[model samples]
Target: MCKAKNMIIENIDELTSRGNKKGRRIVLELVEETLNQVNYYNIVKEVTKLTNDILKIKDLELDLNGFKNVYVIGGGKNSSSMTRALEEVLDGRIAGGVVVEKEGYTTQTKHLLIVHGGHPIPSSDSVKAAEEVLRVLNKVGKDDLLLVCVSGGWTALTSKPPRGISLEDHIAMHRLLMNSGMTVEQMNIVRNHLSQLGRGKVPMFAKGATTIGLIAVDEVEGKPWGPTVPDSSKFSDAVRVLVDFDLLDKVPESIRKYLETAPPSEESPTPLDYMNNCLKVHNLVIADNIRLCESAQKIASKMGINAFVLSTSLRGEAKHVGAVVASIANEIANFNRPFRRPCLLIFGGETTVTIVGRSGEGGRNQELALSAAQYISEGSRIVIASIATDGTDGPTDIAGAIVDGTLVPRARRLGINVTQEQNEHNSSFVFKQTGDAVYARNTGTNLMDLILVYVE
Candidate 1:
């Protein structure tokens, strides 16, 4: 059984009145339960068990004892926990390997060398860590077995710029793309082309080895750029994304040139190329946002609430989505149209924020929650909580924010203009002043973001 931590809403009682405090408490309890189900330690244990059980089937079994070398390599927010689980399962049979994780999330490993890297943006440490991963891959022989563990933050944690591209170029390109409001898929399409290890490039270094990838998927569609799996995206697709994002001219000259000039044949290995190499690789998605949503649904049912999963692939501008959700909740509260009173609506997926101008500290989840606050009708007993599963929503320490119908009125009383904060991309500051932010130190897991709405 998964052990859950307490809900992290600091001013929980203050966010509501005596009339709806019970509803707020129930919502917080549901959130806490859902988060526990996606905890890294619990995920690792569950995936490890599932992997072992699947391997027990005769058709899926591999003789690890026959391999000359058995190694593990990959990185992300959950990489450290995944490595620890692998170490426990494989024991002394594993050879030394490398794994990278976000700073401050590293776990103690006996054989795997843990590298601390940056997230949201790649840094010099990310470059060094990628190089070390490549070195480990080079040592694998034809008969070796390589276990690759990939999770949410792998893109930035394992970032390695291609030759002639400096780390600054990579960072600038990433910042531009992030601020440009491109979807994660679009950004990764361009990113896979510029990096050394993305787009199935990791298997290219394995030569004649057999690679098995255990992935913790953050994206809703189970599309995570496939760092170890065969990549279906083409260089042309990458170029198209750059143009679509209007980043063709804004990005660094090196990045633009690299994407424009690089021939498809010369680009990183595609799905077809992986078949020709003497390497065999398998990619398995052991967890995703769907699983998180399912767990939430079950917990809500247990609480006797009519829980409905609105969408697992929710995506759009954060603030707009927040209002959309509020509109739905308003409809339900006004007429009980969508189910009935005392219901829960759940959604899981990532949202984007287009940084129009100078921005302040805030993440998509925080902004979304704040924006949703406005659309909720006054005196309507509805509460919304939006949170990043990784615990760190953006660059800030807070996971996300929670708001009720009374939030706007409270902010008005405090002379805080919610709309002005939303316009300035300063939702975090507004949330801080209102004591509406949900705080969680890195949960060491990422399955995109989770939004929960409770209508009373």
Candidate 2:
């Protein structure tokens, strides 16, 4: 279990340097406590156990004596932490395995090959990791046991481009999808169509082995996707998403041709196909976004704060979501309209940033916080903050940013142009200059982004 003392945010003093001391304390405390509550290691430990050769996960049980070999495999932001727990529970039962994770996010392991790869985009290392994992999976036999640990960000961490498509073209396709304002689900649908180790293909390589899928989700449904579970999306769906986003021409010609060709044999396993296959699969959602938000709400309530979870499915562009959250807070503070004053509103989910020409550094959460700063009034006493649960926002090391009513005036005094920063997608630069950027190393877990609004 994660302790409050094990803070993922590295620059707490700097973040609390300018905001209302009490408000900053409350907001930062909520972030620290919530992250601890939903940590992957703790969640995995809660649902899994082993005793005298009978391995149990949640309500399912398996007799380890029947299997000749037990192999652990999969990848994601939190896979390393999840693997640590699995290694502890199973002890020395694990024969060998290959697990992939984002660069700089690996943990110490005894019986597994931990491969560090790229994130938000795949690199040559990502492709190599995918190959290594596939090679391990192919070695599994009918009597073998396969433990698949997957989390958000697995799509990029284990990359294997399909035949006729080069790695460069594959990476270019992902870049287009990221900046095209498509949701993560939409992006994965396109990705599931063009990879060898994705869309439930990993399990296919196991050669009839029984597979247990442990998933950590970023949305409310808790439904698992990617390599461990069957994808309901088809080639046509990928083509339509590209067309809907107007990215058909912008994506690489190889990807465009692959999606347009829509080969039936290359299609991912449908739900029915997966069910009838020889691969016996059991899937469980270990943790999710709603669980993370609820933990935050509960912690605030215990502190005598009126906290309410607005939605765990918050979506749309980052800038727009920020404005709406600020507007709601404004109404509550000035008019007591939707919610009364002295309340904490919580939101969770991933947001997209549609990059136009000349994009700047930053992620969606930082953009959200920066946009909210524009509408805050000095006397409103409203504090708005956003952070990626994984402790890395966008391509930067900052987790997210926090802003208050004083942010706009501070920017003016500093000679910073808020609108220009937003237009250029430069939230990281603005927040860093103002000492409000929340910095942290990778948290070894990801559910999505968490936004908190405190009105006093």
Candidate 3:
């Protein structure tokens, strides 16, 4: 059972008062319930059926007696919780291992060495964690069974640059890719080429071990940077992404030269390579945004609101997507074209913010909610909210923001200009002043971002 914590909100009464208080409460409840459904404990119970001598994950089953040793290795935002569950299932049969987690998300574990690292940016600690992971991989024997936990934030949490690529250069390249507004897939394509453990490097090193990847699919499908799975990306794809972002010349010289000089044929290893190398690898997605969205839809139905799930794979610029969702809500309110009145629309996916100039204190979700506020007119019966599942949005303490039609007018009455703030990329500042920002301490899990729209 997952322990319950106080749902953090800066001014709870102030936010609930915007939309119908009862309606706002329903929304908050639905969000909280959906999060609980995908919590680590629930996910482990749902995906794996464990016994004293046999462990089954989906269609794959492992006999504990067949392996000489069992080790757990991988890293991400939810790795600590996942490891705890595995520890309970394995019951002390597992050998020593190492796993990296995002800072502040670590939990007490008995067997695994937990290391905290940075996110959205890789620190020296990330490199240290990666080294530890590599050492574990090297120590695995031919008869060993390796249980891998892959989840969101792995790209940044386990940063290990290839030889000749300095950490400084690697950090600069990562920052450039993030601000370039590239999709997660594109960013990871370029990242796979720069790191040693990325792009099937881990599986390649564990040439003789049987590996099973228990993945928590967050943003993208198939776990793009999965360390234990065979990477299907290519070096050409990395070059193309850099070119598309117009970052060919702007990125660090080391990165540019490495991709330029590296052989194009050195693509991610294929399944055939793994098979020929005498390795067995299985990957199972224990949870994802689709599950989260479906749970929200069910809760909305129980609350007597007509609910429609927009898309679990929503992508693109945050501000534009926000405006588009607001337009849809406007149409629903005016004509009831898509659905009737008293309806709830939900969307889930990761969005990008292309930082052209200096960026302000906000994340993609906050920016999206602030942008939606522009289209909402006074007395308009529409409310929109965007939140990150991990609780924090960007570097701000707030999870995200909730805005209604009256939000803009309220800001204007306070001598604040919403448009100017949006232009300055200062949505967090605006939300702070207006008491619209949603606050929650680190939720210990991440499945990208969620957007909720209510039209009545």
Candidate 4:
């Protein structure tokens, strides 16, 4: 049996040392195994190989002899890991390039310049990284090969607002999007129109070069999330999202006016670019949520626990999803309608938290965990856990949280009101008080979020 390449849970001993030991142990084992399966470096290394000067990644192969220079560039939470793997596989064949990673998520790379940038918000480093990538793209020739390593968080890591938009306005636009209840896809659509490096423009920059994208998908369908993939959204679609979310008036006036009156010439490259050979690109999904969910299910089955993947496309409010998961667990624990006890149920997708007024600290995963704790009954053998696979939940360092039936009572004993915390979106504090917060460094992969429920 192949062992897991990476184990990211830093506090597994602390987490399992107190909670219903056996159940936490099993759930964490699933976490470790599933995360190992999606390690960005491992996934890329497994699928990509260079033998006899020929590069093969998945079904695509390229003869390096035809290329004068090979470069790797892109940005995200997983950029450094992917770039490191490519550097290893390609060895000295790489001609040097630039890729940006969220600060503190970067790993060592030899030939590539790894620029640490800001995420969840853009900073000067983000602009600097964008400029560096553009510099590299400008150097590419028709015989050059460009490897675009993309993953979640790439938008913020390589943000470059348009000509008329200020960095302050760009930041404001993101702030509004975060609180607008819009999904990541919707936000990316709007961002695609405003940012210089977004909306499938990276490949366009290296138009005559052979561009191959190594993407770590956070969405269920694994659609385009950054520069390498063709953006299917239009300027009108971006305008529609802003209007529907009622963020038109709330966002910067420049952003509003740009999206509202942006001409067709400013639109992103469509599928026509590929059909006409104007953009030569190949995108490969190196890792995704479904594969992570399936790995959990497979691991559970091997452990003699019945497992079912509820959904890979879970969305909507974080707290509401928590309630739904708790309700389902209640059904199984009480009467086993949809599933039996001693079963492992899994869900994978990104959930949103629509911030209103002054919000407290927490991410969607933490809020979901806190909300699920409300429905858990005393002495019920249920362990519900949610985690953002990228390892950071919101602006906090916590990956997510785990809860059992006794969570509320335990929190009460410590003077932590679970309901109030959830209301204020202060889930990290609640989890901290209850000793249920999960911690891990960046797991070297971005596949949205994962929630697991183990009932007995």
Instruction: For each candidate, give its TM-score against the true structure.
Output: 0.93, 0.97, 0.95, 0.97
* Candidate 3 structure quality by residue, lDDT tens digits, 327-411: 9999998999789988999999988888888678888999999999899887778878798887788777788988888789889
Ranked candidates (TM-score, high to low): 2, 4, 3, 1
Which sections of candidate 2 miss by over 4 Å?
1-5, 219-221
- Please provide, for model 2 over 263-296, each residue's C-alpha lDDT reduced to its tens digit, 9 standing for 90 to 100: 7878988778777886698888888898989999
In order, what lDDT does every prediction score? Answer: 0.81, 0.86, 0.81, 0.86
* Clash list (residue pairs), candidate 3: none
Poorest 10 consecutive residues of model 2 by lDDT? Answer: 1-10
Clashes of 3: 0
Prediction 2 global C-alpha lDDT: 0.86
When summed lDDT is taken over every stretch of 10 residues in candidate 3, the lowest stretch is: 1-10
lDDT, model 1: 0.81
Candidate scoring better on TM-score of 1 and 3: 3
lDDT of 1 by residue, 1-456 (tens): 223444444445554343357676777677777877777666666655325323321124676656888898868886787788777777677787998989866767778899977788999988888888989988987898888888877888878888778899999998988898888888888887887888688888887788888888886566644678777777788889988877789989988888878766757787678767756877777678998899999999987889999899999999899989999999999999867987999999999999987788899999999999999867999989998887788888888888887788878888999899898899988888877777775465678999999998
